[model samples]
Each structure stands twice: as structure tokens, then as C-alpha cells.
Target chain A: MTTGTASARTRLDPARRRTQLLDLGVGLLATRTLDELTIDLLAERAGISRGLLYHYFGGKHAFHEAVVRRAVEDLVAQTAPPAGGEPLERLLASMTSYVDYVTANYEGYASIVRAAQGGHEALRRLHEQARNVLTDRIFTEDAQGAVIPDTPATRLAVRGWSAMTEELVLTWAADPGPVTRDQLLAAVTGSLPALVDLLR
Target chain B: MTTGTASARTRLDPARRRTQLLDLGVGLLATRTLDELTIDLLAERAGISRGLLYHYFGGKHAFHEAVVRRAVEDLVAQTAPPAGGEPLERLLASMTSYVDYVTANYEGYASIVRAAQGGHEALRRLHEQARNVLTDRIFTEDAQGAVIPDTPATRLAVRGWSAMTEELVLTWAADPGPVTRDQLLAAVTGSLPALVDLLR
Candidate 1:
């Protein structure tokens, strides 16, 4: 049985094994902060030796970077706007998706976002890249940027609004207070256009 | 000559020496990140041997906690709203002070906020306490909470506004682009009340 189990784990190629380990790590993030996800715990969860996990990730630091990058990629992909909709509808759809995404992945997402705030350079860069994709979606929604006006002040508003939206959503997801998801969504959805209107 | 130098270095009592070391660390934060403020570097700048510095601080981790605490206190003090003013004027005054404080202490301020996000527990608590103070000031500006009714929705908006303001100020301080400080201040100052108004 031991031989069979070892072979079952080793059946996958190196690339496949790395992917599997990362996926498990990401899954764990739903319940655990990265700091708390020690190598021993991960290895035990995966039913693999600690040495094997290290072999795949080299070390905790490298493993964490990989996990965060993967999480960011998932976040960016999930938050991507729809293929067809009016500007307002598209924006609402995007916002709703964001609220839902973070709602479902609050622990993982918050930790990643919060960690990026820390001095983690690699994570910060990854986070900034994800943020750019999110912010850039606003401009791309209207090719000429006419609706939003891609000037510095508008850009600043959008960036600021992004921060507001993220903060609100995270707070809402965590405790939600008296606010329902719909109410939360409406407020978040309304605020972006309201902020941009002020710039105009 | 050696004895004179040694005595001069030790001139301050231990408590005073500790404060001076912490103050020096905080000052360094204006230009360098806490991560970059190593004991070796601090000791060199303070003209104290690394051993003496270690004796005072115990370790780097404890030293960082003390520095972050002091920085947060300074930030809170600088951002306290005026004792008397119209709610709107007081809010604006507080916002402007916040912008100016961050402008002067951008590196230190950013690092601390960022580190708080990074899952540094003590730093995160300090950051949260600072955030609470900033948000709570919104309510205290009017004794009745008349201008800004302190509801869950309003509280959420205030918290969100704080995030937006922090992000905008930090970004503006780092790279104003075409946005002037006054313009940035106006946008930030205007946004908070506008956000609260929406909740109404």
C-alpha cells in the first residue's frame, strides 16, 4: 500500500506535480493565510514528503511567490469584463463579478492583497499588474476612452475608485454589517460613475 | 579622547537612548523602508556600536514594532482635526493635513501601511487603530453626528473613503503626473463628503 501510494503521487510529471501542489496551496488559502501554511502542513495535506514539496518549490519563499502569482491570475481572469454590454451594464457586471469573486475567496484574496501591501516586491509587482488589468478594462470598454476620458484626473479617480471598491467589497465580505450583497453591489456600482462624474 | 567619546555616546540615559534610537529609525523611514533600516545601518548613523543598539532593542523585530508604533502616533497627531470648525471645513482641514503628512513622510508612511497589509500582526493592529482614529474623526467632527449620520452604511462609506484617500494621496505623492497637489487635495477632500452623501 505504501509503495502504491508513493507511486500514485510520483505518477505525474514534474510540471504536473508542481501544478498540483500549487492548486492545493491555493485551496488551502481559502481557510489559511499564507504565513500559516507551513511546508510541513502542506506536505502532510498533499500526502507527499516535505523533501518532495521542497524539491518542487525549492523553498517557502519561492513557493509563496508561485501561489500568489497563481491567485492573482485567477483573480484577474475572474474579474474580466463580459464580451457584450453597454458601458454601464458592463461595468456593473464587472463589479458584481468582483464582489462575488472576493466574497467566495475572501480569506485567500484578502491575504494576497494585504500581503502585497507589505514589502513583498514580487507580490507587489504581480498585484500591480493585476490592478492595471482591472483599471485598463475601464478604458478598453470604450476604445476612444470618451466615456471615461483617459486624462490624469480621471485616471486618478478610477484608481481611487478601485481602492474604494476593493476596500468596500472586502469589508462587506468579511462582516457585511446590515448591508445586503445587493445593497453593497449597488453602492459599489453607483460610486464609480459618481466619482468619474465629479472629475468631468 | 576615547573615554570622552564613549561618555558622549552614552550621555543619554537608557530610556532616552531608546527614544533617540526609535526616533532616528522613524526619521530614516522618510527616505528608507523599515526593511532597509538594518541595525548595522542604524548603529552606524547613531554612532553607537551595534552591540549597544542590540542591547537597547533586544532584536530587529522588536525594534521594528517600536518604530512602527511611533510612526503611527505621529501620523495620528498630525492628522487630528482642528478643535473648532464647520464639519465640512474640519473634514477638509483634516484631509489636507493628511495629504501633507503623507507627502512629507511618504516613504515611511507607505512602508508602514504596506507592511500592515503584509500580515505583520503588530503593524496591522497599529495600522487598524490608526485607520479607526481617522474614520472615527469623521463622526466626532459634529457632536450630534448630524452632518454624517453614523450608520453601518455611513461607516462603511467612511471606511471606503479612507482607503481611497490613502491610495490617492500616496499615488499623488509618489507621482503626481499632471495632477497638482491642490487638485489632488480637492478631489480627495470632495470625495469623502460626496461618498457620505451617497449613503444618505
Candidate 2:
């Protein structure tokens, strides 16, 4: 009876357990760098043994990769353009949504950027995927709705635009003044026409 | 006699010794992040005692700050415009020189970028100083010697341009294909007029 009670208390469905662990990781990332995140600490926080944590994540690197992949995916989902509007308006809406998301999730944004800098191939690939999705959205669907032909030069220019937006947004989120959010939003959105022209 | 030999071997003029230590630190940064860098390794490599390393740098954090500041200063010096050319030509030349410097000193640039991401106030300030210098050169001196008033919006745009250049350059350096150096350089240089237009 005692053994059955302990087992019932400890058991969690696999999907729910995974979500629980990821939520814990995302929360911890608010205050700590990936390097500072340790399995021991994570396990302790989750009230699980180290072995149990490893059973779920395999190791810290994998866990980090998972966290980063999920973060990027969440960012993409959050910034996805709303359906049915003029392409330009949708682009602005997406950019506005991105700024809002970053402002709201400064820690998460910083963590993802830090992870991208970490020289891990897995993390770099995840970052690239996010960039590619954003670029495709801008170039394929949002640049006046006629799909722009993709070339190396166009790709590079699109990436440049994305990078500029990311850097400016991150800077603004970190500091939050000097340039008001409206000004920042306008500057980024205004740059889009120039970016499109450059690609052309 | 042994004591005299030991003292002679160990003694270095303070300026010379500081340069030597900085050089060592820079070289080490080529392979290791500041977090991975340790006083013990630096001391061992420099053939000095840990106490002596501290005597010069107080501790690891200060040492990292000094290293990052010097690196940024060196980057600024290396990219400083050459004397007396057409403003546009000099801008292109400066861009060329910057690409050359970053490609040549990839590790140093990575170290500076990593330091910027480290959430250290000193590092972020040093990064801002570097960005300001580059922005001033581009807006005040290089853009046809027309002094653009540095409003917050203008400042943000200039910094955005700078950040775009950096991210693209860093990405090109790391990947080095699909876009040739000439193409990358031209793409970045071509965007300058548009950036200027946006700021206007």
C-alpha cells in the first residue's frame, strides 16, 4: 500500500512531464545563462532525481538544444502574420508583434541570442531555421504578395534586414528609452521598403 | 647570483609587461571564451605567478573588461578611415578594411561580440563606445561629410546599420560561401545610401 501510494504520487504522463521540465527550464533561463544551467540545479528545482532528469533529457546539451529550438519556434509562432490583410499591413503587423513579443520576453530573447553565439552546430541550425522562416515570410508572402524570386543576393539582403530588426529590437528591449517604441517600430517598418528595393 | 638571474629573468618594465600580458590574453581569446579563460592558465602560459597576474588585473572580471576594451579599441583603430579621399570612396574603403579586419581577426571579433552578450555593464558600455565611433565615422564624416544631427532616431538607425554590417560580416566570415566577399561588400556598401535616405 505504501509503495503504491509513492508511485502514484510520483507518476506523470510523459508529455506532461516533458512540458513541466521545459517550463522549468524556460523559467530558469530568465535569470541564468545556459552555461550556468546545471542538471543538478534543474533536477533539484523539478523535484526529481538527476537520473530521472537524464532519463527525460539525455544530457544538458540536448536539453539546451531542445529549449532553444522550442524558444525559436515560439517566437516564430508569436510573430506569424495575422490572416487576410494587405501584404504591407501584414508585414507591419508582424514586425509590431515581434517587437511586442521581444519586449515581453526580453530574458528569453537574450537567452536565445546567447545560445546562438555558443558555437554549437545544433543551436546554429535552429537559429538559421528561424531566420529562414522569417525571411521566407517577408520575401514570399509579405513583399506586396507577389513572390519575389529568391537569389543569393536577395537572401543575403533579407537576412540583413532580419538581423537589423533583431539587433534594434534587442537593444531597445534592453534599454527601453532614447527611442520610443513607436519610433523604433516606425524605423524598422520604414526600412522594409528600402530592403525590398535593395533586393530588387 | 642565482637570485640575480631569477630576478632578471622575471622582471619586465610595467608598460612592456602589460602589453605582453594583453597580447597573451588576446591570443588566448582566439580559442577560449572569457568564461573559459582562467588566471591559472594565463599565468602558466606567461610564466608568471597567479598572484602577479592579480597584481596587474585585480581579478578575472577586471581582466576580461580590460581585454574587451582593448580589443574594441584595436578594432576601431584598424578600421579608422585612411586620410583624404572622396567621402563615399573612403566609406567603401573603410568598409573593405573592416571586412578585411574582421575576416582576419575572426576570433577577436567573436570575443568582442560574446563579451557584449555577457550582460556585463562594462562590456556593454565598451561595445556602445565602439558602435558610436563607427556610427560617427559613417554619418558625420563618411556620408559625403554632411553632418547628420544625432537625434535618437538617427542614432538608432545608424546603430541599426552598424549592427546589420556586423551581423552580416560575422555570418559571412563564419560561413564564407553562397555570397562572395565582393558580393557581400557590395551589398553592404550599396545599402548605405538607403540607410542615409531613411535617416533623412
Candidate 3:
């Protein structure tokens, strides 16, 4: 029953179908609020039977959780701390990577945030898992790697930076045109040395 | 027909009625999803006539917006830095106030956040207005009081602090028990000396 394009038809393998569903879901999420996203419409738009969606995810909540997990995983991978550099330099590099990731995948990022706000319990778990991993990475890899002592001061520094990064990115996502990616990166890097000193 | 004890009877005034309705909205918001808050239910539990609610707010959306605005304004007011204090001290004080405000009004804050996420344009406007006021207060009042010069670095320092405060409060509101309010306040204060150096 596909009526539009050739690429839309033959790309119906299970992997492709799953990707297609996520893509459709992400697109819908951008223009419409999450409350309105329904399984029937997601399946209809993806050119897949409703049964197939259930086959893959068992339910819409599961599908949503899967989508959120993938998004968070991608974000974490993109912002993973750099190795073999000076601590401050590596931390700066990671912040640059993080800004780039959020700017590029702003929609997916926003969707995960919205889900974290009030989505299903599974989405909350996925969000928490991603946060825990990222926070741990910052503590062990970024802040500690810089030779910053593991004192309470350093811990506070890391938490402050982490908090600001999320806040700035969230605002940027809401209105990207006003706050460019460069400004965001500069904001993070510009504040890093001061953050590093807290560890000392 | 008014009913119940002295505490309930005291809320029959127009201003208190509005407050009661909004508080009830916040209460309902925590238990049920935002999409479920309706005028009839709000009015019924509020023990106020539907006509009176409409008179106070024009409609459900207006009432919701007012409630969000009131909560945000309260937060902004409470978090504003006190005059005649050192920049760092004032910043710490502001952070403590913010943490306390969010912790005390977790559900009300969540309701506003949920309403904003729902693409409620009026609520978004109110939220942004409160944020801009906070940002401006930090720059004009708090940052102006800093011993450091008002350079770009100083501005960015304020920005970093502002971002951290907002993000920490938002995360805290979403999940209150994991991070204690004192821990968050201490974390920000501990990072301040380093952050101030960056600004200078």
C-alpha cells in the first residue's frame, strides 16, 4: 500500500522498518507534542502493520523507551571524553563534541528530554541510566584526568559544569537560531579553567 | 454551598479562591498527567463554581497559565540575590534559596514544566519571562556587585552560574530524593572561587 517513493517500499526489512519507525516518531515529535503520538498513526505512517510494531517492541511504551535509550546512548557516545590529552584540553574537547552532538541531534535530544519530563516509567529509567553514565564519565575521565584532586571542591566543580551544560543545551534546543553552536561551545570552554581550579 | 472547617472556610475569598484552585491544580498535576487536568474537575475539587473560575481566569488555559506564572514568579523572587553581599556569598545564598524553593514546590514546578512542554504558548511566555528576569538580576545586581571587572569573562561567569542553578533545580524537582538540597548548594558554592577566576 506504499504510494510515494521507491526507497520507501523495498526498505522494509526488520532493521530498516525499526529505523523507519523511529525516524517517523522523531519527526512527528518535533512538530507535535508527545501526548499525541499514537501506535496506530506511527504504524500507518511507517508503512508497517500494527502487528509488526508490537512484534518488535511489544507495545508503544516499549517502542518509546527503545527510542529514548538509543538517543541517550548516541548522545553519550558522541560526548565521550577524549583520551591522551591534557586534562583541561581533553575536557574542552569533550565539551566541543557535546555541543556538536546536541546541535546536530537537537530534535532527538529534545524528545528524550521531553520524555524525561513526564513520559513512561521505562523512559525515566533510560534517562537515569544515561545520566548516571555521563556523570560518572565526567567524574572519572574528564575532571580526574585533568589531575584535579578528588576533593569535594573538584566534585562540586564537575557537578556545576554538568548542570550548566544541560541547561544551556536545553535553552539552545528550544530556539537554536538565536544561540549558535559556537557560542555554546565557547561558553563551556571559557568556563573550564575556573572549574579545573576548584579541584586543586 | 461552603462546607468544612475553619481552614477550608478561610479560602472563600476571591484571591484565596484563585490560590486554592491553583494549588488544587498543582496537587492534581502530580498524581495525573498534564493532559488530564480539566476545568470541570478543577472546579469541582476546588469547591468553587465554574462561573467563578472563568471569571477569575477566563478559561482553563488562562487559569493554567496564571498558576504557572505565579509559581515561576515566586521562584524568581525567592532566588534573587540580596543586596550588599559579596558576589560569591550572594551567589551561594541565591543557590540555597533556589534549592529550597524547588524542593518546597516540587509538584507546582513540575506542573509548570509539564504545561510548558505541552506547547502551551502562554505558559512558555511566562516561563521565559521569569528566566529573563533572573538572568538580568544576576547580571545587573549580582555581577555588578562583584569585585572583578565587568568583562566578557565576568558575564560568562554569571552565565555559567545561572545555567548551573537552573539545571540543578530542574533536575532536583524531577527527582528530589537522590540529591539533597544542601549538597547542590554546597556544590555550587564550592565551585564559585574557580568560576570567579574564569570570569576575571
Q: Tell me, by lDDT, which candidate is best.
A: 1
Best by DockQ: 1
Q: Could you give the candidate ranking by DockQ, starting with the highest?
A: 1, 2, 3
- Tens-digit lDDT string for candidate 3 (B53-133): 789889777777776666676677788887776776887788788777766666556566655643566776786677678
Model 1 reaches an interface RMSD of: 1.7
Q: Give per-residue CA lDDT, model 2, range A41-125, as digits (tens).
A: 8889988899988888898889888777767777788888888887667777888999998877677667677567544658767
In model 2, which residue pairs have backbone atoms overlapping below 3 Å? none
Error of 1 at B69 (Å): 2.3
lDDT of model 2, residue B191: 71
Q: Write one digit per residue (lDDT tens) for candidate 1, span B131-184.
A: 998788788777687578888888998899889988888888888775777777
Q: What TM-score against the true fold does each predicted structure earn? A: 0.85, 0.69, 0.64
Task: Tell me the deviation in Å of residue B16 in model 3.
Answer: 6.4
Binned by DockQ into CAPRI classes (incorrect, acceptable, medium, high), candidate 2 is acceptable
Reference A-B contact fraction recovered by candidate 3: 0.24
Q: Give the Å error, residue B102, model 1.
A: 1.3
CAPRI classification of candidate 1: medium
Which of the predicted structures, 2 or 3, would earn the higher lDDT when compared with the native?
Answer: 2
Give a tens-digit lDDT track for model 3, residues A1-200: 56667865664577876776776776665455455667787888877788878987788778777666666766788787777777667767788887777666666576666566443457767776776787677668844454555554454555656767676666655565544466666666766555545334
Q: Where does candidate 3 stray beyond 4 Å?
A: A1-64, A119-122, A140-160, A170-200, B1-65, B83-93, B103-124, B142-160, B169-200
Ranking by TM-score: 1, 2, 3
